[model samples]
Target: MTPSDASPWNSPGTVRQLGKMLFDHNPTLKINPSVIPSIVGWGLRFLANSTYERHKANMISNIRIARLSLEALRSIRQTAHLNYDQTTRGTMRVFPRGGRMTEFVQMCREMKQWGVQFEVLDQNQILEKEPCLGAVIDRYVGAVFFPDDESGDAHKFTNEIARLATELGVQLLLNTNILKIVNGSSSRISHLSTSRGDVSADVYVLSLGSYSPILARPLGISLPIIPVKGYSVTVALNGWKGGPTRPVMDDGYHAMMVPMGDRLRMGGRAEFAGYDTRVDEEEGWRVLDDIMKILPVLRSHIDANAVLNWSGLRAMTPGGPPLVGPTSYANLLLNTGHGPLGWTMACGSAKLISDLITHRQV
Candidate 1:
């Protein structure tokens, strides 16, 4: 089977479901809520002037939560294989537009005010940091380096966390289909009617990612969640010395490559293709072509046969923030529409939900 056919997780729907599952069980097994109501999307709107200050605060909060997650993984020896490899290595966000960089510099300043270490770099400085960027340096004007940002295998991280959750008495039912969410009296979640049987919970939190809006429609909750399909290809390093040692985003091409162990994961582009998971071979190659633009030297080193292509649905909200909070139902809560930053904000969202459920101050 080809990589697309061989891997079940390659489908857009599967990845979204897995992401939700990861967050759901990660904190749920500990009796802590795995979903939370949060206004965490404000931080990602770096280009918007109106919310720049709020965005900075959100960025700081996200960084802190990411650090907390790294610390949690560090405490456990089994997580080592998950590549929770903590590094202070910064990420370079390269954009083609030079004039717009001024706004980014101002945003960096705001981030610094919130204690996020960031540096604005010119084209030469961008190439100096990562020579892999030399391929497309001329296509971009400058870049921003978030010194404290991090990257890890979201798949592995989720698996490790889920394993720990299972070991701690969380019952993991894999491949089970949830048909519908049933609401009973007084706008309270009654029970989730699944393919297997009806499972009831005192409190129900929606962590279904792209599927949240679909499931909520029956209950009269209209969520502004759109499934944006994203593609990724994992290219084996195979002793390719020119490979980047850190994550680099080609803002011009809208593609990013993250170094994970011996493999380079290149992910980019958002296609509003509904729930379709089929990846056109030509389109997949196109994504690789974009990767080549950013790392031309590594093109020859990349073993075409060894590349693992994948497509996932990102439940992108209109703005960048997720809709996290109590829905119309008293017992039903929402934790979906996280888009690309779900992994970065997972633990924090989980903790918030747990705190809210227990009546603690959020």
Candidate 2:
């Protein structure tokens, strides 16, 4: 969300059998004892229902939503007059191993069919886009550049939106904790039982990130969402001119380094620790190490002791796309379960939910 919050808007492993195929890539993934049975049960259901056709359909839906959301973000930035270290140089995904480029090429071709604009760049082209990466250019075979993609301080954008909404006569409720959702007699949300008091709304939108399922369960809605924890570390450039100018996704380590204004934010690692938002300093350092492995020039410029470590939970669903739109309860709509792409797809998802609520054709 911001440098302060662990949410990436600004911005998983199995047993031995599942590990190599799925989990091994994420060494940080760990399941809480309470969620083990649930995880296993959901895993079985996922495997059983998963099909190549189904996966393709989901991917297509997610990609469309993401592309639309990018445009929405641009509009919001203009509306809010936001310029919090916003980078429009586009984003890049570097494939350290040459073999990975082949798979990416195939994916790019398929994406191109959907009108997604991307350029497949060799090592030299990648360096040209971000000269700070020259130190590790040899380590990369090629990269896929998404020209439409952008990066910025999600926290600042969120706050600006909130401020704008308030100016539009929207009431701002702060420090009020929602204890539960009170159901009405006729398949709808009657009101919310909050820590402050009981508040009623004609319609309610359940956009409570990872905690959405907790309240929905009492209402007989079986939300297949899990809280996946992720880690991030932000380091000041400290006059280091060699840091990346834009966002870079490292394929080898499954991480991202985003230049947020003068600060460089590097975050990655999916740990299924379930609601534990504890920051592991060592893990943060490990992320730095992973980044340094690719950009060795930053080694001398960064001070390890000054890095800020943060952790946040993501609401992930079995299917990649978020569970948006109306639920069984007519007045209660869903806008959660976005996982790691919450910030990227926020505006599009919000627009979709609003259109649905207003009975507008989407």
Clashes of each: 4, 5
lDDT of 1 by residue, 213-290 (tens): 889998999887767677888888886668777788765555688888778888765554567778756556777887
TM-scores for all predictions: 0.76, 0.90
Could you tell me how far off, in angstroms, the CA of residue 76 lies in candidate 1 after the best superposition? 7.6
Question: Best candidate, lDDT-wise?
Answer: 2
- Residues 189-223 of candidate 2 have per-residue lDDT tens digits of 88999999999987789999999999999999989
Candidate lDDT values, in order: 0.65, 0.75
Clashing pairs in 1: 33-354, 37-324, 37-325, 41-321
Per-model RMSD to reference: 11.2, 4.5
Candidate 1, after superposition: displacement of residue 265 in Å? Answer: 0.7
